[model samples]
Target: MTDTGMTAPEPTAIDETRQRELQILSEDAVLKGHPHGDEQCKNCLYYLDVDEAISYCWHPKLRVLVGQDWYCQWWEEITAEA
Candidate 1:
């Protein structure tokens, strides 16, 4: 049998397509420069990446995509990811 350890199964064609669509992006959106990086997104008073494009106080529901580096004044780092 071939060595499975060396080469993991690649994502299915459909899974690959979906992942490409789900990956972080900054299109027609702002790449916010967070003073706290991940800290901000995770600790914002209202943090949620649901179906809607979220923000500290702006961003309409499902109107825009959030940049991974986006941040606002209402940011905090409660955990390592934040």
Candidate 2:
């Protein structure tokens, strides 16, 4: 995976707009900052691993398809189901 090093969008002065932008931007930062290693989207709780190479991150703010090798700060170990 490639690291884009691109920063999040700057916050505007509007309170509501800034707050929402900050939230999304922070989450984006977390996703980009995650270390590239054994920790990957496939094993994360938020990932819906439907195939080997690609999967969906079900996070509310960051719903998107991620690769097996891609990871983020939001990653959590898969839990056992009852």
Candidate 3:
């Protein structure tokens, strides 16, 4: 018997507007240079380089986009927020 575990579909609607929004998010909250008092968005679980837009987060692969700043649920902290 094949064990076919149900899985959430990948995100697909990540268009230019979405990308821009997320980019703004990263710039505002993630890259605000808050002093590194906490983790930056770059190191979070949702954080992905511009090259790997096709990649999907294991926890909640539903919400996706090219850039990493795209917010979701499975995000993790790498360092304190600046």
Strongest candidate by TM-score:
2
By the lDDT metric, which is better: model 1 or model 2? 2
* Candidate 2 C-alpha lDDT tens digits along 1-82: 6779987686557978867876785677476534467677777788786466777778776776677777777777887970
Q: Show the lowest summed lDDT stretch of 10 residues, model 2.
A: 29-38
- Each prediction's RMSD over C-alphas, in Å, is 9.5, 10.0, 13.4
Task: Report every candidate's CA lDDT.
Answer: 0.46, 0.71, 0.47
TM-score of 2: 0.54
Model 1 score (lDDT): 0.46
Candidate 1: clashing pairs of residues: 38-82, 39-82
Best by lDDT: 2
Model 1 CA deviation exceeding 4 Å by range: 1-7, 24-39, 48-82
| Model 3 lDDT tens row, 10-42 | 656677677788677555443342224344334
Model 3: number of backbone collisions: 10
